[model samples]
Target: MEKYWNWEGNYIGVRQKDYLTACDGIILGKFYGKEIYDQNGNYIGEIGKNNRLIKNKTKENFRRPGFSFYVKGTITAPFKSCDPYPMIPGYEDFLR
Candidate 1:
């Protein structure tokens, strides 16, 4: 399975194999653990197994080009204030 994070670097959701399955226009790829890359190969962010942002490796206020709307509209707004520790639904006991 693949995990997803919001623009502000909070774990927001997940999919079976493709993390971008529900994303509308963002182009990203999973690169082991929680490293994600943009369409042009920019290292955007890294998420922990517990679904928290690894600040040192993540860009500040990073938003993918051409996909800012999706990030600002849906991904960031809702989960901005939520905790990052809770494992998303299917990821409970993930990597255990």
Candidate 2:
């Protein structure tokens, strides 16, 4: 359903090594000093490890050397329900 609809967004660039490291260290990095438990055996909340872990992971991702990658540019349409970009008229314009 998401692919069927047009959404305006930007791309993210990151390194492969960083990605793997982040994925492997996520659960451990999310460890807060305090832990919360629910009535059942489920876990509820943590103390102060949300934003800190995210920032650390982001830094780690950018630190990898020569790991450059880019994504497609963003396009913002005038109409919310439609994509008014690539402004018609020339068949050759569609190629881009």
Candidate 3:
């Protein structure tokens, strides 16, 4: 495992495991409680699992640099708002 501090002093952890798997695991843990079932649909022991197809697809999309960039590249205005949309910090380079 490797650790680094961001400019804001937030400690970021890096694992030897693949980043995509780690991120999916994180999403699964956040959305689904600790319980996974086997293929037979039996109540298996508790384990961090991702059962949502949409969420898993999103994770896959985020793993691709181009796909992630395209999704984050543009901002859509609200249907009934004049307020300027907020830009993602450190994404000024992308905008240019």
- Write one digit per residue (lDDT tens) for candidate 1, span 9-75: 4434444343332233233433334554444445445565445434333243454433232331113
How high is each candidate's TM-score? 0.37, 0.17, 0.22
Q: Whose TM-score is higher: candidate 2's or candidate 3's?
A: 3
RMSD of 1: 10.0
Q: What TM-score does model 2 achieve against the real structure?
A: 0.17
Worst 10 residues of 1 by lDDT: 70-79
By TM-score, rank the candidates, best first.
1, 3, 2
How many clashing pairs per prediction, in order? 0, 0, 0
Number of the candidate with higher lDDT, 1 or 3: 1
Residue-level lDDT tens digits of model 2 in 10-46: 1111112212112222211111233222223223222
Return the clash pairs for model 1, or none.
none
**Colliding residue pairs in candidate 2:** none
For candidate 3, the lDDT comes to: 0.21
Question: Which portions of model 3 miss their true places by more than 4 Å?
Answer: 20-96
Candidates, ranked, lDDT: 1, 3, 2
Error of 1 at 67 (Å): 15
> For this target, which candidate reaches the highest lDDT against the unseen true structure?
1
